[model samples]
Target: MTSSLFEPEPGKDKEASSASMPPALKLSLEMGPLVIFFVANFFGQWLIDHVPLFSSFEKPIFPATALFMIAIISSLATSWILARRVLVMPLVSGVFVLIFGSLTLWLQDATFVKIKPTITSVLFALILFGGLLFKKSLLGYVFDSAFQLDAEGWRKLTFRWAFFFLFLALVNEIIWRNFSDDFWTNFHVLASTIFTFIFLATQMPMIMRHSLEQPPSDKNEDHAD
Candidate 1:
């Protein structure tokens, strides 16, 4: 009935304590919603059809919405426990999930749920790009605590990610609007994961190239300074 979650793993274990935390931990935490969504969808029918607390969630729509809410809360709790604060992007996504998921269930239309990822992606792109427009590296706020990238490297990485998320948004909109639920679901999980992993892999060269060539403590910043 309960599960003990392992503490959030650090992204760069090599310099584990040097960095605030790991990007991988943030990535894994972000997956919390998707994992909950998929699991809830998969077993929804069985529960609503048999169980009582979920009896009110007899409909697929309600169960899906309920799961979104539960996932958001759980994600916030996890982040609070690990980082002692709620992350911005996850909080943003959670708000959208609660809002749109509620609309989908209330309207008995799945379109709202289907568009959740698209909306999330687009919003992320906007936020990232907007920061760049003002010559601000907002990614620093999210990733600074994780891996330390040089200023130029952080700028380039943020811009690339902004565009990448926009592209993903377009792809999600196209697929969900045109394809069957089974097709969308399968591609959402499998294809998306593969694409993301490959994208992260492709960034290795940039990461290595921009890494703090030496420890960033006093003597190092002073030498560079």
Candidate 2:
């Protein structure tokens, strides 16, 4: 069966699958790969020295990218086994990880992996804006079950998210170019998560303001009275 990335599965609401997944487990699964990436980057040589399999990687980043690719695959597989389906957000990220991680390994250059986040962010922004051009609020496919909102609300939220994605892309470009690889690695995992949480929190007020949960019957009753 065909499925849209942002669309919920048949016979299930958008929130159903998400609700069934425990918050802590979901958080761990999502963060696990980045943690692996960070640790591998830092301690790769020790692993290379001790683990014969990793010895061929001349630099830490190479093995780190390889380990990261493995970690992302493992994470995606585990997520599918546990949740019965992969989350679109992480699935998209995993795809980029595999693609750029492979390039990093095959080309023996770190630039591909380093720019993965920036490219992913830009791609997401493009998807969001493209949805708008079609007169569709595709973000609603991802979030409608959680936040009941009118069309206008979805449009506003989608526009905000698209811009936020662009901002993320810019931040990633600036950091990776200006900072040390280690520092950029740290920022990749930590700063992005913090910024995303802050952005989501900031959107709550607007979401509440446009909520569509009140029953139409209630409105009709009030009008009759």
Candidate 3:
């Protein structure tokens, strides 16, 4: 099963089972808003010029941000309507989008909107590290439904994810501050998504090694008894 932005902690919400959508649909729901945001930014000027519908805004970025904000909200609403519950990460990301997106529109400064991803990444990194300090494997809570790993596996996986988030935060800061707006927006959608999928793929071995499957011997013994 594909993991959601907010994974239900194990044993916490029975209702999540019925609420969950198919994995492919869930991934689409998660990625759709970002894809829209990227397209809006990439083609904002053309949209403004060619589409009378988008001409009301003074600048391309303004309308793009507005559309992006609406997309985020719409995505979240759809998730809730379909799943009956929100995942943690998407919910956090959606809140930041609404906040910074509103600020960007009101202040007419894209800087606020650009910093939202950095803020979210850093916040996720901090939460993971803080959980580690307390000897809690919070990442397990996020992935427990997908992978039943041993304690050490969970710890290692959590550590890896914590560092990965920190790296993403730093990368976002660098790209947005040093690059053109168009470049940054494109990178935000593409690079981050690619890196995340790659990271998850690289963890397959560790996940298999720590999986909670019973041995053949154990199954045979149980059957004999």
In candidate 2, the residue pairs with backbone N, CA or C atoms under 3 Å apart (3 or more residues apart, or in different chains) clash, namely none
Poorest 10 consecutive residues by lDDT, candidate 3: 216-225
Cα error, residue 126 of model 1, in Å, equals: 0.9
Total colliding residue pairs, candidate 1: 1
* lDDT tens per residue, model 1, 147-172: 56777667777898898889889999
Per-residue error for 159 in candidate 2, Å, reads 1.3
lDDT of 3 by residue, 74-156 (tens): 87788777776575667788899999999998887889988999999899888889988998878865576567666767877
Winner of 2 and 3 under lDDT: 2
What are the lDDT scores of the predictions, listed in order?
0.71, 0.79, 0.78
lDDT for model 1: 0.71
Q: Per-residue CA lDDT of candidate 2, range 18-112, in tens?
A: 56556576677778999999899899788889888888777788888888999888987886777666766778888999999999988888889
lDDT of 3 at 161: 95
What TM-score does prediction 1 earn? 0.78
Best-first order by TM-score: 3, 2, 1
